[model samples]
Target: MKVTQIPFQKIGFFSKTMLDYLEKNPKINPFYNNFPDFEGFQKQIAEKQTSFSKSSRLVLAEALKNQYESFEISEKTKTNISLLKKEHTFTISTGHQLNLFTGPLYFLYKIISAINLAEELSVKFPNQNFVPVYWMATEDHDFDEINYFNFDGKKVTWNRKDGGAVGRFSTDGLDAVFDVFSEHLGNSKNAQYLKKLFADGYLKHHNLADATRFIANELFAKYGLVIVDGDDAKLKELFIPFVRDELEHGTSFKAVSKTIERLANNYKIQVNPREINLFYLGDDYRERIIFENNLYKVNNTEIAFSKDEIFKELHKNPKAFSPNVIMRPLYQEVILPNLCYIGGGGEQAYWLELQDYFNAVNIPFPILLLRNSVQVISEKQARKLAALNISKEELFLNQHELITNKVVENTAIETNFKDKKQFLEQQFLDLKEVAKKTHISFLNAVNAQERKQIKGLEKLEKRLLKAEKKRQTHLVERITILQNELLPNQSLEERQRNFSEYYLEYGITFIDVLKIALKPLELQFTILEI
Candidate 1:
C-alpha cells in the first residue's frame, strides 16, 4: 500500500468555514478555543485538567462500566475504560449516526482518525494516556439518514417504521437486509466473515444501540476504542443541569444565536439555534420543546409544562430531554474529558459556531479536528492515472473540465487561445489610444469591439477543444472510465461507497492500511493506492 497526502483546499469539496478553521485563520480563531495542533493540544490539556473535575471522571468511568457489563470487550478497551477515571487520561472522540453497516466509507475514516490521533498523542505526552472514543449518535432521531448503505453500487437498506431515538430502534427487519447483502458477497473467506459479522451484529442484538456498539467495538476494540451511548439515564443525569438551564434561560439559544451573527459576517451559518435547543424524547416520539404562553410544550404533542412543572420533570426524568444539533457538541464535551474532536467538514462547521455557547455554560470547548478523508485507488487505477498524465489532484476537477484539459494537453491542435487573446487585447489597447487621439465617442466603439472580439475568441476556443475531444475519443473514454471507477457518481468515493466493498477484497487489512495512513492532525486529504 502507498499513501499520499494533499491539502484539503486542493480537494475542492470543503467549505470556506472548514478550510479557514483548518488554516487557523484569525477570523475563525474567535469561534473556536484552540487550533488542532500539538501546541493547541498542550494548552488544551492544561485547560481541561484544571477545569474538568475528578468526580465527573469517576461518574463517567462508572457509567461506562455499567454500560459495558453485558458485552465482551478487549483487555485494551477494558483498560482504557478503567483509565478514564484517572485525571491524566483524556479522550479523542468522534461521533457519527448509527448508520446501517456503518453508512459510508468515511465511517471507518472518522474512527481511524480518532484512534491514530490518540496513538500520536500517547507518544507526544507519554505521562498522560489518550483514549480513542466513538460516541454513538444514538439520541439522533433521523432514521432515514441511517437506514441504508451502498455496497458495490447497490443500496442495502433496513426498511422500518421507527421514531423517537434511533438508538432505541428495534433491529427486527435487518435479517432481510442481511440476506440481500449476503447475496452480493460470494463464499470467499472474507465474504463469510462479513456475513457472520452482519448476522452477529444486527441479528442477535435487540436494539440499534447495542448492535452499533457491538459492531464498532468489534472493529476498533483492539485499538482501545471506547464507544459511548449517551442515551443512558446515568449519562443524562450529568446533563440535567444544562437541560434545566435550556428550559429556564434558553442559554444555548442566546449564546449560539449571537455567535452565529458574528460568524455570518464572514462565514456561512451551519445551524440556527431554536428558542429551546432541547428535545422531548419519549418512547415513541422525539420532538422539539418550545416555549410559548408561559409554558414549555413539546412540539407535535399535547405534553406541556409550566416553568416550575418543567423543572420538576427535568429533575425526575432527565433522560426524557435530548440535546439538538446546537447543544449536542456541548453535551459531548461536558461528558467526556476530551482533548480533540475529529469529524467531517459539516460537523466542524457547526462546532465552530458553539465556542461562545461553551463559554456561557463554563464548559471547556475541545479542539476541533477535521477527520481524515481518503480516496482508495487500486494499483491498476493508479497506473492508468499515471499513463493518462493525470495527477491525483487533477481527479478532483469537474469531469468536463478534466476532459477538456486532458484533450488540450494531448492534442496537436492549438486549442488554447491565450496568446491570441493577449495579442487581441494589445491591439485593442492600441486602438483605444488611436480612438483617444481622434474622439471620446470612438473609444466607446473600441471598447465594444474589444468585448465582442474576446467573446468570439472564447467561443472559438471551446469549439476547437470540442473538436479535439472527438479526435481523441479513446483517451477521453479511458479517462472517463478510470475516473468514474475511482470517484463513483462524480462524488468522493468515501461519500458514496461502503467499506464492505473494499473489505470483501482486502479484508481487515483495509482498515489496517487506513489506521497506518490517516493522520488526523495533518488535516490533509489522503489518497491510498492499494
Candidate 2:
C-alpha cells in the first residue's frame, strides 16, 4: 500500500469555514479555543486538567464499564476504560450516527483518525494517556438517515416504523436486511466473515444501540477504541445541570445567535439555534421543548410544564431531556476529559459556532480537528490513472473541467488564444490612439470594434477546443470511465460507497492499511493505492 497526502482546499469539496480553520485564519480563530497541533494540545491539556473534575472522571469510567458489561471486550479496550479513571487520561472523541453497517466508507476514516491521534498523543506526552472514543449518536431521532447503506451500488435498507430516539429502536426487522446483504457476498473467507459480522451485529442484538456498539467494538476494540453511548441514563444525569441551564436561560440559543450574527458575514451558517435547544424524549416521541404562554411545552405534543414543574422533571428524569445540535457539543465536552474532536468538514462547521456558548456555560471548548479523508484506489485503477497521465489531484476536478484541461493538453491544437488575444488588445490600443488623435466620437467606434474582435476571438477559441475534444474522443472516454469508477455518482467515494465494498476483497488488511495511513493531525486528504 502507498499513501499520498493533499491539501483539503485542492479537493474543492470542503467548506470555506473548514479550510479557514485548517489554515488558522484569524477570522475563524475565535470560534475555537485551540488549534489542533502539539503546542495547542499542550495548552488544551492544561485547560482540561483544571476544568474536568476527578469525580466526573469516576462517573464517566463507571458509566462506560456498565455500558460494556454485556459484551466481550478486548483487553486493550478494557485497559483504556479503566485508565479513564486516572487524572492524566484524556479522550480523543469522534461521534457518528449508528448508520447501518457503518453507513459510508468515512466511518472507518473517522474512527481510525481518532485512534491514530491517541497513539500519537501518547508518544508525545508519555506521562499522560489519551484514549480514543467513538461517541454513538443514539439520541438522534433521524431514522431515515441511518436505515440504509450502499453495497455494490445497491442500497440495502432496513424498513421499520421507528420514532423517538433511534438508539432505543428494536432490531427485529434487520434479519431481512442481513439476508439481502448476504446474498451479495459469495462464500469466500472474507465474504463469510462479513456475513457473520452483519448477522451477529444486527440480528442478534436487541436494540440499535447495542448492535452498533458491538460492531464498532469488533472493528476497532483491538486498538483500544472505547465506544460511548450518550443515551444512557447515567450519562444523561451528568448533563442535567447543562440541560437545566438551557431550559431556564436559553443560554445556547442566545450565545450561538450572537456568534452566527458575526459568522454569517464571512461563512455559511451551519445550523440555526431554536429558542430552546433541549428536547423532550418520550418512549415513542422526541419533540422540541418550546416556551410559550408562560409555560414550557413539548412541540406537537400535549405535554406542558410550568417552570418549576420542568425543573422538577429534569431533576427527576434527566434521561427525558435531550440536547439538540446546538447544545450537543457542550454535553459531549462536559462529560469527557477531551482534548480534541475529530469530525468531517460539515461537523466542524457547526462546531465552530459554539465557542461562545461553551464560554457562557463555563465549559472548556475542545480543539476541533477535521477528520482524515481518503480515496482508496485499487492497483488496477491506479494503473489506469497513470496510463491516462492524469494526476491524482486532477481527479478531484469537475468532470467538465477535467475533460477540457486534459483535452487541451493532449491535442495538437492551440486551444488557448492567449497570444492572439493579447495581440488584438495591442492593436486596439493603437487604434484608440489614432482615434484620440483624430476625434473623440471615433474612439467610441474604435472601442466597439475592439469588443467585437475580442468576442470573435473567444468564440473561435472555444470552437477549436470543441474540435480538439472530438478528435481526442478516446482520451475523453478513458478519463470519464476512470473518474466515474473512482468517484461513484460524481461524489466522493467515502460518501457514496460502504467499506464492505473494499473489505470483501482485502479483508482485515484493508482496515489495517487505513489505520496505519490515516494521520489526523496532518489534516490532509489521503490517496491510498493498494
Cα lDDT of model 1 by residue, 1-530, tens digit: 99999999998888998988878888888988888899999999999998778988988999999989889999999999999999999999999999999999999999999999999999999999999999999999999999999998888888888789999999999999999999999999999989998999999999999999998988989999999999978788889989988888889889988999999999988799998999999987999999999989999999999999999998899899999999888888888999999998898899988989899999999999999999998998889899999998999999999998898889677878999999999999998889998877899999999999999999998888888889899999999998898889999999999898999999999999998999888888999999
Model 2 gets an lDDT of 0.93
RMSD of each: 1.6, 1.4
Pick the lDDT winner: 2
**Model 2 ranges off by over 4 Å:** 437-442
**TM-score of each model, in listed order:** 0.97, 0.97
Clashing pairs in 2: none
**Relative to the unseen true structure, what is the C-alpha lDDT of residue 84 in candidate 1, on a scale of 0 to 100?**
93
